[model samples]
Target chain A: MSNKVIEISNLGKQYRLGQVGTTTLSDDFKRWWYAFRGKEDPFLIIGDTNDRTKKGSSDYVWALKDINFSVNKGEVIGIIGKNGAGKSTLLKILSRTTAPTMGEYKIKGRIASLLEVGTGFHPDLTGRENVFLNGAILGMTKAEIRNKFDEIVDFSGVERYIDTPVKRYSSGMYVRLAFAVAAHLEPEILIVDEVLAVGDAEFQKKCLGKMKDVSGNGRTVLFVSHNMSAVNSLCTRCVYLKNGTVYSIGDTAKIVETYLSNESNAESCKVWDPSVAPGDSVARIISARVTDDKGLTIDHMLRDQKVGIEFEYEVLQEGHWPIPNLHVFNGSEEYAFVSVENELEYLSKKGKYRSVVWIPADLLNDGRYVFGLALTTMKPNVNVHFYAENVLQVEVIEDISKRNTSYNQRLPGVVRPQLNWETTLLSD
Target chain B: MADMKTEPDEEHWDLVVKPKSSLFTLNLAEVWAYKDLIMLMVKRDFTAIYKQTVLGPLWMFVQPLFTTAIYTFTFSTSAKLSTDGIPPILFYIMGQTFWNYFADCLNKTSGTFISNSAVFGKVYFPRLVMPFSVVISSLIKLGLQILLLMAFYLYYYFTTDQLHPQWTLALLPAYLLILGVFSLSLGILFSSFTTKYRDFTFLLTFAVQLLMFASCVVFPVSMYSEKVQNILMYNPVVSCMEAIKYSLTGHGLFSWYYLSFVLLVTFIFLIISVVIFNRTEKSFMDSV
Candidate 1:
């Protein structure tokens, strides 16, 4: 038998551009008239491509257009895209909460989607009642819920408050209980969209583990999330959507690398005109750049080589004692570290200056990173003249040839430094 | 050949979703498959409404009782309208009991899309489950209000000899089924329309209120002229209310032709409304 569980062919969804009522009655009549004559909808050919930023002339836009993909029985697919890139629209179509405007899809088994957790949970109902209610809303029979009632309660860890209305439960307990009911659902195909973004890290991990266990039993899973780390760990295959279309689909690591590199909108250098630069009268930023050790500007960094981040600014006034600082963040927005130029003294005269910080090799894990530049004064209540966030971003690629081990998995951490180690063979 | 082997026969796939389906494709099996969700929704509607209340489900009786008292005071005592020889309390309570059920079902289910947009936007089941469950839950209140009517029935039965519940009383369930289907159809019809234009929602509430006077809830249909009675029978609720009142008190018009007219209108509207509901549910998220 074929293992393919879902096959979507040329699926597309078109949406009206403005308020739903903006479509005139004449337009609806015209479309209906076309269809009544056994012809295609006249408006379908007039929609602009999906781009939320651009204001198109047409009143209809294709939120998703000409999409084709399929999923096997046991594969976990991650859908990654920028906001408004039709990720949610695609999931909604698969979940059957909405239908596409064109094309079709076939599924081989039972499908359940958690476009959101706690979908039908009523606040006035007790936690126990909500479990059964939400489970039924998720398509579980009453008897099926009864069979796993105890397990669901145990998993939620809210047994003491099971009989209390969920409105009285703390937010964390509510999510835990809601997620427990969903996790116990035994559908053959599951689609989750960012429900794991709730609760604390430990609860999220537990939910991920339950999903992994579900997939381990040969069930198919489709996950959509902007958290690349979670996607990297959970999804075996990745589908990258760009501007409401499938840009690539392949192995998880390869697609994730492409997505992260493409997401780095900033280049090695960003220069602003002095007249409109970001700063006050006392100081202003002129440019920011990322460079290699040889002083050549580069858009990316090598894991085994040194890199430098430099900020150039003009000081229009004297005696401000402005302090230059840089904040580094990893791909997941985790704070890496902050560096300050404490060794430089305050310049008594007005002039332009450049501050450079060299990042040691092996200090950053292989992924994407962003830099933020700011100029602040420590004296007189610590005033900041200007702070620019995400001034520059670059990708850190690992050099496989320089590796000392055969391990090929991505090392987890915000910072990966080569610390000194002393090993002695005392027995010999 | 190998690729062809991997792709199974068209009939093997369990579910196939399309953009549009025929108007007659009602999918009663899908609704049947979601029966558990229907029952759970019924339970939620019943239990959630009475939470934090002083008397809880007792309010079901309180509402119709007060409404009957007000109607009797307004129509019987003040206006001196004829109750067709039945006691004003018993007559108004009987008519209001069935009328309230229809009105309640219509009002509750009319907002099905807008009120439950949160749940509908995130999950997929048979969207019809909500309106179906609303009708079912109101049946509970309908049962309690009937008990209140029965209490007045016994009081008048012992104190006076004006009671004659005929063999036609056996048709009470049939009338209720007609009433339920009628209101549910109009409810969902308004719901689908309101999803796109909110005017229907505003139109529904006052329309149902105005519908009560035409349905002869507070007065007897006998008080109206022959031509007016003919026009009133076109309103499906009028025949149902007349049949239910006549069966209980032997004081209202009950004709098979009118009942069948009500049934046919309800059945046809039920088909149209359900089709519209199904079509709206597929894409209402974008508009709602």
Candidate 2:
């Protein structure tokens, strides 16, 4: 039998741009008139591609247009996109919370979508009651919920408070109970959208583990989330959406790399006008740049080249002795390292100050890196003057010539530094 | 084309989502498959409303009892409305019991899309399950009110020779069945429109109040002229309510033609409402 459980083709959804009012009736009339005369919908041809940043002349926009992909049984597919790229819209259509305006899709077996957890949970209801209520809302039968009632309670770890109204439970406890019900849903095709954004770190880990277990049982899963690391670890394949259209669909690593690299535009130098620069009364970041040792501002460099992050800031108020810090993050948003300069010999008059930190050659992995700049004071209390999260982004490319090994492939670890080694051959 | 060879039977696919969904798609089987959900929703609606209350479920009896008392006080002596020789308290309670159920069902089910939009937006089930559960939950409330009515009913039957419950009392379930069908269908239809437009909500609240006066809730149909009676019987709720009153007190109008007319209208409205409701559920998320 064919393993492809879901087949979507040429799917699209068109939405009106503004508030529904007088224009809706006219549009409806126009649509009716066209249909009556055996013509096409007049507005269908006039929609702009959905790009929330830009204002378009047309009153209609295609939130998703011409989307086509198929998922085989047991394959975990991650849908990643920038906000308003139709990620949620696609999931809504796939889960049938909404219908597409164009094309069709066929699916085999049951599909359960958890676009949100605890959708129908009543605050006055006890956690035990909410488990059954939420499970039913997610399409579990009473028998199934009954069968897994104990297990769900055990998984949520709120058994002591099961009979207590969820209103009294902490938000963490509530989400745990809700996700517990969702995690126990054994559907053939599960479509999840960012339910892991809640809960503590440990709970999130448990949820991800449960999702992995779900997919391991020969079921198809569609996951849509902004957490790149979660998508990287959980999904085997990915579909990257840009401006409401499929940009690429392939192996998770390649698609995620394309998504992350394309997302930030990889700026090496960012300069701001002093008046509008990001800062408090203490200090303001004037400019930030990433450069190679040759002093050329660079957005990409070979792994063997030393990388320098330069920040220029003005201290508006002086006596506090401000410290400049650089926080480095890899492509998956995991912090590689944070470097803080705490040595300032004396507190002096306010003026422009520049700080630069050099990352050693071959010390970082060959992936996109983001630099965050912060000016802080450590006096009686620690206070951040300003922190620019994504001041500069640089891609470190692999240098094939530096390695003599037969394997010319990417190595594991956040930093792939070349360390001095002594190999004493023991009678091999 | 390749699918035709690889999967010869398209029926092998469990679901086929299409742009042009058919209008008459009422998946009774799908609704049946979600029976547990429907029952759970019913329980949620039933139990959740009474939570954190002093009276709890006892409040169910309070509303109808007070309404019956108010109706008897206002319309019994002051308005001197005819009840066809049945005592005013029993008459008012009988009508109030059935009317409250019908109105409660309509009122709750009619707000299914609006009231449950938070839950509806995030999950996918047969949207019909919402209104179906509303009807069932209101039936449970009605069940409680019926017991209250029976208390007054038995007292009147014992004391007054005028009280005579006909053998048609056996058809009480049938009357309630018609009532459920009418309210469920009409409520579902109203809910479909209420999803997009706010006007229907105001109109429905106003219309339901007006509907009670039009139906034989507080007064009997016998008090009206032939023409007005003919017009009143056209309301499916009128026939169902009068049939219930007749089965209980044995004096209200119970015509076979009118009952069947109620059935027919209920049947037609059920089909249209389910179709419109199905279509509404598809894209209501956008407008809602």
Candidate 3:
């Protein structure tokens, strides 16, 4: 037995497209009239899958469709999806805030969600009063809140002003107190969505630490966020959602890679968005990527292996030998190398172009590196068309097991070269 | 399909979500679990309202006090309505406290959706706690108003021979019980209607005011014609109010017949209201 806590099968949620849900009152009456006579729901027959990009024929759309996933005890699972991809809707259903339109999910523990912090906080209530009120709202009994009362006050760091109304507290103090109350909640299954965006960096760090502590004690956590790094560090596995359905669900790194790759504004590879591209109307970088020797984009590369840097851009009014420049820098703000595409001068069309620059293996030291890219005209004033700072980052690692060098100790300098090194002892 | 076998091994799951629950299932255990929320909501209503007000909870008594004055001026002196020969202030205070409690419970509950949409939208608790807490808070206010009535009763007892404690004073618990149940059920029923058709909320305001005239609030039923008396006697609030009056001031009727009739009506209303409330709780957030 996996000690499963949640099991969802064929789960779906169909929502009406706009404000007026499920047709007009007259049509709803007709639908109800038909249902009263044992006929199928007339509207349900016409509803379609929810894809907002394209106009569908039906007025009803499935916000979540045919989703199936089970969660075991103590699993810290990250739910990552684009906006309107039904991430919130799924959490809503799991938290029982709303009923599912189709299918069912069985949850085998007390479930709580930090859909929003400090929910149902009365402004007039003191910080101490709100703690108890918010705790009870999250399903903690009075005795449970009392038992954790002192610990809660201590964690909030507003012990001196606990008796003061929360409206009098600063925004940071408000968040600390709100987070402290939520942090004390220890349900068997916890669902958190994007609440970490609040508070300062230090408080955010504290909350993340608190969450780590909670999950460490074998509680199932369902976290949803667009912050991929946080998810990568905290989540053991990830469920990648696309258009209201599970696209993939697997190890956190792989799922994050797939999810980021799908995004046009990825950390390492940015497929051009017309509205957000960095260049003028003439020419723009459409997409950029850090790839390995196999020509597949990767987030990290072994330092001993050669890697390819590729950029695909469109030259609208082509001319002037617009070359793509690549600047590689290690973590210490030192440039490892710089490369610019050497193109034939002033000879290009008004169409798409692909540029590839390969960096050889065993040349750079093992460290975190970034690619700062620029598209510049090679003539006249040497105008920079687009200069994207830190456009992509890659981690280079040297595996000791795969190395043939006798030198295992630390070495200096920004670059590691497999150069010829031999010693001759003639006097001996 | 193989995962279904795990069900037998784990019979201690705390929650189970399904597309549908049995229609008749009250699921009172779920309601029982949220009792703290109910109490906290009661405290919220009590304390949150008086945050900036100068008089604070003193307003709870002042409300019924002024209403009694208006009823005494308009109904006693202006309309020459009889209060079973009891003093006007004491009689009106007697009826106003209980009726105001019931009316406020119903009125506030009628807007449960519009007022608490914030709390309701983000969280999942037994939605009945909202209306239940509304009644308890109003009940607390009523308790305060009763203290005012006691002061008037004591003055009338010493100054004149108009007040006397009857054996029926022992039935105060039953009277409050019947009144509380009847008001809560009726309030919840109206609250259910407001969720679907908000037009009822406007109607509820004026309708409650109009119903108060037909009720035994300002005057005792003994003063009305027998035909009118029998009709007003059917209202549970009428018998409950009359019993409270008879217990304290030794005026008005306190018959088992009226008490049993009110009990039956309250029981039926309770069942119907609970059914509607549970049904509304499922998807009220959708429309509301």
DockQ of each: 0.67, 0.64, 0.47
Model 1 lDDT per residue over B47-137, tens place: 9999999999898888878988898899999999999999999998888888889998999999999999999889998889999999998
Q: What are the candidates' interface root-mean-square deviations? A: 2.5, 2.3, 1.9
Range of the 10 consecutive residues with the lowest summed lDDT in candidate 2 chain B: B1-10
Return whichever of 2 and 3 wins on DockQ.
Answer: 2
Choose the strongest candidate by DockQ: 1
Give candidate 3 misplaced runs (Cα > 4 Å): A21-24, A39-42, A265-428, B1-12, B220-224, B253-255
Q: Which residue pairs collide in model 1, if any?
A: none
The residue ranges of model 1 lying beyond 4 angstroms of the native Cα positions read A274-276, A280-282, A300-304, A316-321, A331-333, A343-351, A366-368, A378-384, A394-412, B1-11
Model 1 chain B: which ten-residue window has the lowest total lDDT?
B1-10
TM-score, predicted candidate 1 vs. hidden true structure = 0.95
The lDDT per prediction is 0.88, 0.88, 0.82
Q: Give candidate 3's whole-model lDDT.
A: 0.82
Q: What DockQ class does candidate 2 belong to? A: medium
Clashing pairs in 2: none
lDDT of candidate 3 at residue A171, scale 0 to 100: 87
